[model samples]
Target: MADTARRTDDLLAGLPVPGARSPGQGERAAGAKNTARAARSRFMAAHGEEVYDRLTDGRTRHLRLRELVDAAAREFPGLVPDAAQLAQESARPQADKDGREIDQGIFFSRLLGSPLAGPHLMDAMLRPTDRALRLLPDFRRTGFADLGSVTLERRGSAAHLTMCRPDCLNAEDNEQVEAMETAVDLALLDPAVHVGLLRGGEMTHPRYRGRRVFSAGINLKSLHAGRISLVDFLLRRELGYIAKLMRGVLVDHETSWQSRTIEKPWVAAVDTFAIGGGMQLLMVFDRVIAGSDAYLSLPAAQEGIVPGAGNFRLGRLAGGRISRQVVLWGRRLWASEPDARLLIDEVVDPAAVGAAADAALERLDSPAVVTNRRVLNLAEEPPEAFRAYLAEFSLQQALRLYSEDVIGKVGRFSAGCAAPPA
Candidate 1:
């Protein structure tokens, strides 16, 4: 009987039980392992002592015992854990969520203590919606080593270029000019970009730092010294090249159209004297926002040279009488000139110039319309001559001659006609 009992015990130990299986038995062992893992998982999830100990510290994301209980109730159906139990388990103290703290300060006392509390409390406890703040000109990461001390930022769809080069009003060296031009061209080429804001290349005013001034002109010292200069030949070449490039963009069969895949309107706020080449670029823009502290001049005549590209274009835009005075005499026109036709559009206060540009931009809805109209009107008179020139000189021939000859002739003839008969 004892031998039989011993044999029966041996059989029970060797054979698989209801919940247990031998590890050496592959398929059965895997099933057993899975069951063991599931049981361990349930136990761990219920206690989670190891997880809590590993993850939490004194500074860990701690919630109030009551809040935890409430949250648990929300997550688990009909299972609201005890707040006191949670408080005992989790030693971390809880005051309130940051948002709730704001609400408490705003409306907690009033609600708890007043008759007017209930109705107003809900409203007061509400927080204002938060919005993402972004850097303007979106140029936060942009850095230019050769740009001297100028820093540019984005303002809406425009790139705002500011010269932070001390109060010396040092004229633009080649490095500075190249940097500015490259940066401007980069921003201009971008389809998303619209306008550029230029500021502080000059002092506001030497006597009054707040008053504002502009850089005198291209650094003549650098120019004459030949260290880095704006020589006439180089200037003419560069100017013609840039103007031609701009005309291509502005008059392209595709880009010229406002609805094209790529197109933009440009404007600049001249804070001070945009003299020489700097002033020349301003004419290329659709508009100029002249600061009250600003002055516009053409100083090539003063330098015993012609403004060339600048003078020719200015003459077209401003008419001969005014253009001659501006270029030949180098007259400094203030931003508030009531009769200044050359400036284009309105003369506004410096502070209001930005707003004015925006208002003007709103009015010019279609760049295509503007370009086409100007092209047609410029091509209207001297059609045969323009066509002949167009065959040789192309569109530029018309733009230049129309101003020099057409306007000049028309003005002379009109004056002759209006004069008293001899």
Candidate 2:
């Protein structure tokens, strides 16, 4: 571990300092840009392949991957922009798009794009988070885990994993993502549960007061506040809980060929709306039940970021044109609409959502549900394809997260000038 840490420190040290200016007069700015470019090239030449090899060496554990990231942040402060810096950057009228941390994004983009690192990264992410591991034993015994932003309660044959950020309409943030994934781990690992049900808790937001909302997607407030991290929130999310929702929990560290996973059919009950990430999640569920008055939309264009795996999976569920309409054109599909039926398995009265979910969960708890779901997943996504999509997504999303457009959009949304994407 000491040797590895030393080597890692050396590799990180080679990276260009974010705003280092070459010492001189008049031509200092241009000279700094040129110097930074040279430094980057030198680092890539010396350490790029080594970094890939290290990532795919198959010896480093998931915890070690996190340790390395933490080390990078500690050793090179601005390299991995902490939460406070991220918040500061988000609130700026014009963000520092080419800031020091942008290089960190570039590093991850290249790293994730590697054929070796791509799948390895997927494997690492699929392993349950440490928080899940810590809480699992208690949850397994009690069949109930109340993770602050989300909760897991095993009810009969179904494990109800409720997203509970009522104040934010269950919008996903790092803490929520961690909690949700941990709850998902509990649900999948519990032997008594045959089906997993996802639903949002009641909201405190005035417009949706006392009402349950499926999700408002990424917390725009958090994003505008710079509380979101490129790796921890963006990459970890799609690759972590959301992917776990589709693929299942990795139970053993065997090769992908002989891997063991604990998986169950999942049912999503959409109450008020499934916006952005919420809508993206529906693509992975085995069954979806929505209130007739509910709606769905992927406002990726409006938000100026990729809507998780929506691009890869939405087309598979709703076909090309409609997928394009929702993802690219900002089209919202109400549950009653014909197009909505493509994504929603059942649309019932708002009051009937619970009953509808119960029925779906009952049906999903059958002996063949897991087998058939696995077959369907293999036919449609296959782990390899999903892994590749996320590899590219990590890079594209990192860039977008720091882009001026996203910062501006988030700023407007934060200021209450921009309405939620319809």
Q: Name the runs in model 1 displaced over 4 angstroms.
A: 1-146, 163-170, 199-205, 230-233, 240-245, 248-263, 358-422
Model 1, 265-335: lDDT tens per residue? 55556665556655766665666677665667776555443343565467667778877787777676656
The model with the greatest lDDT is: 2
Report the C-alpha lDDT of model 2 over 1-422, residue by residue, as the tens digit.
22332443344344433234233421443344335544543554456547555544543654323454554455444334445544545554334323434445555655556566656666777787778888878887888888898888998989998998877788888888778878888787777889999999898877777999898888887787666766667777887888888888887644346536777899999999999889988999999999999999998999898998889998888899998899889999999999999999999999999999999988888868887887788899987777667766755786688676888888878763222543
Q: Which pairs, if any, clash in model 1?
A: 136-154, 137-153, 137-154, 137-155, 203-213, 204-212, 204-213
TM-score of 1: 0.46
Mark the regions of model 2 whose C-alpha exceeds 4 Å error after superposition.
1-49, 55-60, 63-65, 71-99, 253-259, 416-422
lDDT on C-alpha atoms for all candidate structures: 0.41, 0.74
- Clash pairs for candidate 2: 87-226
RMSD of each: 31.9, 5.6
Where does the lowest 10-residue lDDT sum fall in candidate 1?
Answer: 95-104
Q: Provide TM-scores for the models.
A: 0.46, 0.83
